[model samples]
Target: MTLSIDNLQQMEIEYIKMFSEVSEDEQTLTFNNSNIPDMYTHNFDLYKSDVGLLEYIESQINKVETKAKGFFRIETYHPISADLIEKLSVKPQICTYDFMGIETRNYINLIGNPECSVLSAESSRVLEDGITVDIAVNEEGMGLDFATRRIKGKAEVYKNPDKAIELFVCYSGDTPIGNIEYIPFNRVAKFEDFDILEDYQRRSFGTSVLKHLLEKAFDNNIEHAYLITDQADTAKEMYKKNGFEKVGEKTELLFLF
Candidate 1:
C-alpha cells in the first residue's frame, strides 16, 4: 500500500479540509497525526487570488483538529486573510513569526542607523509580568553575566538572587520604572535578541537592542542573524525594514516541548 505524489497531494488537501472544521485554524495543518512537525515551506502565489490559500488552509485545519492526537501547524506569507485567520481556535503554543535578518557584513552598518542610535531607544533584554520579572540584568556588569549564563544553560534556576542580571534603560533614576532582564538564546536568531517589560513597548526600543546584539554576534564571528515573530502581524513588516525576508515557514513541532 503506497501513495503516489498525486495521491499524497490529494490526501494533503483532504486532510486540510477535514482539519479546518475541527481546528478552525489552517495554520495547524500537518501530515503527522501525533504531532505537527516544524517544517518551513513557502509559496509566493498564496495571495494571488481571492480566497486562495486561506480557503484551503481553513478547510485543512478543520479536518486535523477533529482528529487531533496532539497538535497542528501551518505557515504562509504575511497578510493572510484577516477575517479567515481570526476564525482559528488553535491554542498558539509558541509563535516564531517575525524574523529579521542581516548579512554578516552589514552587521556593523546597522550599528549607526538612527533606529539603533537613539538614546531613549532601548532593547527588550527582559520581559516581565507586573511584580514578578522572569529575568533581569544589573548595571555593574551583571547583564553580560546573566546573558552568558543563559546561553550556556547554567542560569536555568533563578531562585538564587546572584544568578539575576541588572538591566537599565535611558531614563536616569535610582530605581527603574520598568525592569529589564537578559533573555539569551542558544542561537542568535529570533525574539529580537532579548525580551523587555511589557510596559515599554512600541517605542522602537527593541530595534536598537537588536542592533547591539548583532554587533555582539558579529564580534563573536556570527555570519548570519535572524529572528521570528507572528506570521500575521506588523512584526513581519518591521523585520522587512530590518532586512529580513521570509526564507520558509516552519510548521509546529508538538513533541519538542
Candidate 2:
C-alpha cells in the first residue's frame, strides 16, 4: 500500500498524541507536555497560513513562555509568507524538514557492515551518552550549546512505555556510538533521533545502523518506514541512497527566548 502525504501527517499526529496533551480546532493543533518542554512536544501546528491568526498564536505562546523557558514554535503545512514572518515580535529561525519514506520490502536483502551491529536498548542511559557526545562535538563547531535540556527531555520521552517506542543503540564491537528511535503503528514504522557519534562517522556505521533497522522492519511485515530529516542535513543523502524518497515537507517557524 502506497502511503500518501495525508497518511504520513495523520501518523505523525498519532505519534505526537502518544506522549502529549493534544488539542485541535479548525485552525490549529496544540501539543503540550509540561514534563518534556521540548520544541517537538510543546508547540502549535497551524493548519492554515492565514496571517490573521498570528496575533492569537502569539498571545497563546506568550502565556507558555511565562511559565517555561524554551522555544515557542509554530509549524505549518503551508509555507508562511514573508510578510507574515516579519510580523513576529522576535526574529524567528525557520527550518524545513523533508518527510522521507520507503517500502521496507525493497531493502529486505540489503547488507550492513559486519563490524557494526544495532540492538534494542532497554535503558535510555546508553542513548543519552551517545547524544551528549554528538552534541558536544556539533556544538564545538557550531558554537552553541543547548543539549542538556534537549537530551533530558528526549530521555524522558524514551522512558514512556505507552508510546511503544524502541530505542536502538548501535555498537561497534561492544562500544556504543550511535542510536535511533523506532515507533511502529498500523504496520508502518517511524524512525527518529538517528545519530552517529562524530568520531565514528565517515565510516559505514550509519549505513549499518540504518540497514539493521530497515531489515528489522521488513522482518516484522512492516509495509513502510518513514523519517523526517532537515532539508539542509547531509544525512538525507544517505537516506535516499538506501531507498527512501521525499514524500513531503514540514515547515516550522521557531523563536528562542
Candidate 3:
C-alpha cells in the first residue's frame, strides 16, 4: 500500500489512544487520573480562527475540571495563536516528532549484526554476559510531569493489566543501555521508544537492534515498518542514516498548575 499523510496521522492517533483510560472523542482525549500530568489530548485540527481555538481551549480546561485533576496537556495537529496561551492561562510547551516510515527501496534485504542479537524475551530477562532483549514503556521515571524531573514516577501502563505492549531492551556487556518497543497494530509493526544510554550510544548497538527488528519484519509479513521520534539529535541522526524521513508533524502543548 501507499504511505500517505493519512496513514501517518492515524498511527499517531492510535499511539496516543492507548493512554485514554477515561474518555476519548473525535476532538479531545481525557485521561481520568490526576497524577498523570498529560491528562488531556487535543486531537482536532481546529486552528482556523482565534475564536475557535479559544473555545476549544476552554473546553479542555472545563474537561480537566470534570475529568482528571492534576496538571494537563493539549496536543494539536494544527498551530494555535500565542494569544490563546494568555487567554487559557497555560504555559506553552512546544514539541515536534518526525513520523518516519521505512521505504520499500531501503529494505534491500534482511541483514543481521553479530554484536547485538535480538531475542524474543521478557522485559525482566536478565543478561549474564551481554545485553539481552526485553520490553517496557520508554518513559522517564518522572511520570508525565513536564516541569520537574525530580519526582520519579511511572506511567499507568506499567501496572495496567489491560495494556498490550512489548518493550524491547538491548543490553551491551550485561548492561541495559538501549531500548525500543514493538507495537503491532493492523498488521503493521511500529517500532517506537528507540533509545540508547548516553555512554553506550554511537557504538552500533542501536543500528544492530534496528536491523534485528527489520530482519523480523520480513518474516512477520508486516505491511509497514515505522516509528515516531522527538527532537533528539543523536536518535534522529541514526534513524535518518538508516533510511527514515519526516512524513508528518503534530503540535503538543502542556499546562501546569
Backbone clash pairs in model 2 (N, Cα, C under 3 Å; residues 3+ apart or in different chains), count? 0
Q: In order, what is each prediction's RMSD in angstroms? A: 13.9, 3.4, 5.6
* Residue range 3-116, candidate 3, lDDT tens digits: 665676566556655654446556554444334444244222223232365677666656756245454455555566666667775555667666777753355543434466
Top-TM-score structure, candidate number:
2
Among all candidates shown, the one with the greatest lDDT: 2
lDDT comparing candidate 2 with the true structure: 0.74
What's model 2's lDDT at 110? 57
Choose 2 or 3, whichever is better by lDDT: 2
What TM-score does candidate 3 reach? 0.71
Off by over 4 Å in 1: 1-99, 111-131, 134-194, 253-257
lDDT score for residue 68 of model 3: 50
For model 2 the local lDDT of residue 189 reads 91
- lDDT, residue 216, model 1: 55
By lDDT, the candidates rank as 2, 3, 1
User: What's the TM-score of each model vs. the native?
Assistant: 0.38, 0.82, 0.71
* Alpha carbon lDDT at 211, candidate 3: 74
